[model samples]
Target: MLDPRFLTIPITHRGLHAPGVPENSLAAARAAIEAGYGIECDIQPGPDGEPLVFHDYQLHRLTGAQGFIAATDAATLAGLRLLGTDEPVPTLRQFLDLIAGRVPLLIEIKDQDGACGPNVGTLPARVAEALAGYDGPVAVMSFNPHMIAAFREAAPHVPVGLTTCAFGEDDWARVPPARRDELAAIADYDAVGASFISHDKDDLDNPRVDALRAAGAGILSWTIRSLAEEQAARRIAQNVTFEGYRAAY
Candidate 1:
C-alpha cells in the first residue's frame, strides 16, 4: 500500500485508454482526469527538438506512419492521427494543459538506445520548463538512470522515479549471472537517490523494494491489468499502473 501520508494512487498506464480512447493521446488523459485517476504518459523528443507523448520507437505501430518518433518534427507528428481516434499526436505540454490541474501526472521518459538515443540533451530542461509553477503533483519517471539524474539536476523540486523490469532466464543467458546482482544493486542505489522506484509487479516481492521503502523511497508498480495483480500490487506498493478498467478501485 502507498504510505498514507503521501498523496498518491495507482496511476493509469497511458491514461486509461480503452476501446474508444487512444493510448497516450490527449483524449485518453482527459478520460483519466474525468475518472479522477492520475495520468502516466511517455515523453520523447521530436526531430525539431519538441517534447511529444509517445511510447514506441517507431510510429508505425500506433500511427500508420513509418520511421521513429524522433525522425519527424512536431508538425508532422501533429498531422498523423493516433490509432482508433482522430486525436493528433499531442505534445507533452498539450496533454498537461488538457488535464488542467484536474489530476497529478507521472511522466515517463522513453529512451531506447540508437542514433536517437534518449532525449538526453535538452529534454529534461524542456520538461522542467513546462512543469514550472504548476500546482498539481508531478513526478518524472524513466528506465534510464541517467535521465533521472539529469531530471534531478534540472528540476530539483519535482520528484523522480526509476523504472526497472526483472530479467528472465533468456536475459541471464546473455549476461553472466554473477553480474546481475551488481547491476541491480547499482540501479537500486540510483533509485534510492531518486525519490521513488517504479518497477514491475514482481519487483514488489524483491528485497530491494523493502530496502528502498525502509529508506523512505516511494514504491510504484506498472501496467497492472487484472484484479489479482491489482490486489498483489496493493499489498506491496504505494501505487499500481492501470489500464482498461476505469471503475476499478
Candidate 2:
C-alpha cells in the first residue's frame, strides 16, 4: 500500500535544494526537514552495490566529475563535492539516519537498464537491503516498470510506484519511442503491483491516471515549481514532488 503520510505531507523535490545546498545532498535533506516538508530523493547503486543518494547516472552535471555513478566506488563518491558546495554525495544509509523518520521520504530509483526495459541489475536487492530496518515514511518509484517489479519482489512491504510522463520525444530521447508509447498507456500498473503514480504535472489530465484515481490509487505529481503550480497540481494529485520553490500548501 502507498504510505498515507506521503499523501498528506508536502514534498520537496530533491530535499528543498537551494544555493550552496545541492540537490540530494545531506545538507539539502536537512533543509527540507527544517522547512517541515517531505523529502523526495533518487538512488543509484554504487560500484560495489551500495545505494547512493543521487540523481543522474552521469556525474558531471551535479559533481563536475567524469564518469557514471555506477562506476564510482563508495569512498570516491563520498569525496567528490557537489557543485558550489562542500557537501559530498551521501549514501542512502546516511540520508536515512539523518532523517530518522522526522519527515516522509520518497526515493526514486533510476533505471539501471538504460533502456528502462527488462534487464534490471542488482539494484533491487541492494536497495531492499538498505531499507531493511530503516523505519520511516518512505516510498520507492521509477520510470521503468521492470525495475519496480524487481524491487517489489525484493522489498514487498515497501510502497512501489511509477514515475509517469507524456514522454515527449525531445524530453525522453533515451527511452525508445516504442517503450515510451507503451509506458504512456500505463499497461503495467496492475502487473507490477504499483499502488501509486507520480506523474508529470502537465499530464495528470490523462485518462489512464484518472481511471486509476477512480479505482482508489494514490496520485502524486512531480516538479511543481511554485505555489500556483502546486495549487493546480493538487486538483488531481493528493500531493506533489516539488522543487525550485517552496510549495505553500
Candidate 3:
C-alpha cells in the first residue's frame, strides 16, 4: 500500500504551475509546497543519468532549446533556462534537498522509448539513487511499466505506481493500437509491483479501474482543472493530481 498521505492530500500537478511558473520548474514546486499541497512532477534523465525535473523529452517547449534531453549534457542542461524564466532545470538532487521531507512528492519518470517498448535506460536506477535516504511520503511512477519494474528492483522500499490512461490516438500517437489497448487495460500493474495509479481523470468510469480499486489498489486521477472536476474526480479517485486551477477537496 502507498503512504496514506498520498491518498488524502490534494497534490498539485507539476506543482501549482501557472502562466509565469512553468510546469515542473522549481518555482512551481515551491509554490505548491508553500500552498501546503503535495507535489507531483515529471523527471527526465540527463546524459549522466541524473534526473532533471521536467516533463518533455524535448527541450523546446520548456527551454526553447534544440534536441531531446537525452542528447544534452548536464552542464548544458544546467545552463538552459525554463520558460524564459531565471530558473534553470533542477536536478532530482536539488529538488529533494529543497523539499527536505516537507511535503509528499510524486515523481513521474518520462518514458524513454517513445513507443513504450523497452529501452528504459538508466533513468529509473538513477532516480532511485537520487531518492536514497530521502525521508518523506515520496513515490515514483511511469507511463512505461518497464521503468517501474526497474525502479522496483532498485528501490523496493519506495512506493511504485503506474501512470494509467485511455491511450487515445490524439495523445498517444506513437504507441501502436495493440500496445494502446494493453496499456489502457493496465495489464502491467501487477507485474511492475505497482501499488497505485494516477489515471486519466475522464476515464475513471472504466470498470477495470473499479476492479483495481476493489482489489485494493489506490485510485488517483490526473490533470483536473476546476472545482467541479475535482469533485467528480474525487468521487472515483481518492486524491487528485491537478493543474491550471486550484483543486478543492
lDDT of each: 0.73, 0.90, 0.90
Candidate 2's C-alpha runs over 4 A off are none
lDDT of 2 at 113: 84
Task: Score every model by TM-score.
Answer: 0.86, 0.96, 0.96
- Cα lDDT tens digits, model 3, 1-249, are 599999988999888888888888788889999998999989988887778898887999889999989789877887899899888888888889888888899999999888888889989999989989999899999999989999899999999999998999999999999999999999999988899999999899988899999999999999898888989988889999888777774
Which regions of candidate 1 are displaced past 4 Å? 1-7, 112-119, 167-183, 186-192
Tens digit of lDDT per residue, candidate 2, span 74-131?
6777789998689988989999999998999998988888778887888877888889
Which scores higher on lDDT, 1 or 2?
2
Residue lDDT tens for model 1, 149-181: 776787788877777656444644443455445
Task: Count backbone clashes in candidate 1.
Answer: 1
Q: What's the lDDT for residue 48 in model 1?
A: 72
Q: What would you estimate as the lDDT of candidate 2?
A: 0.90
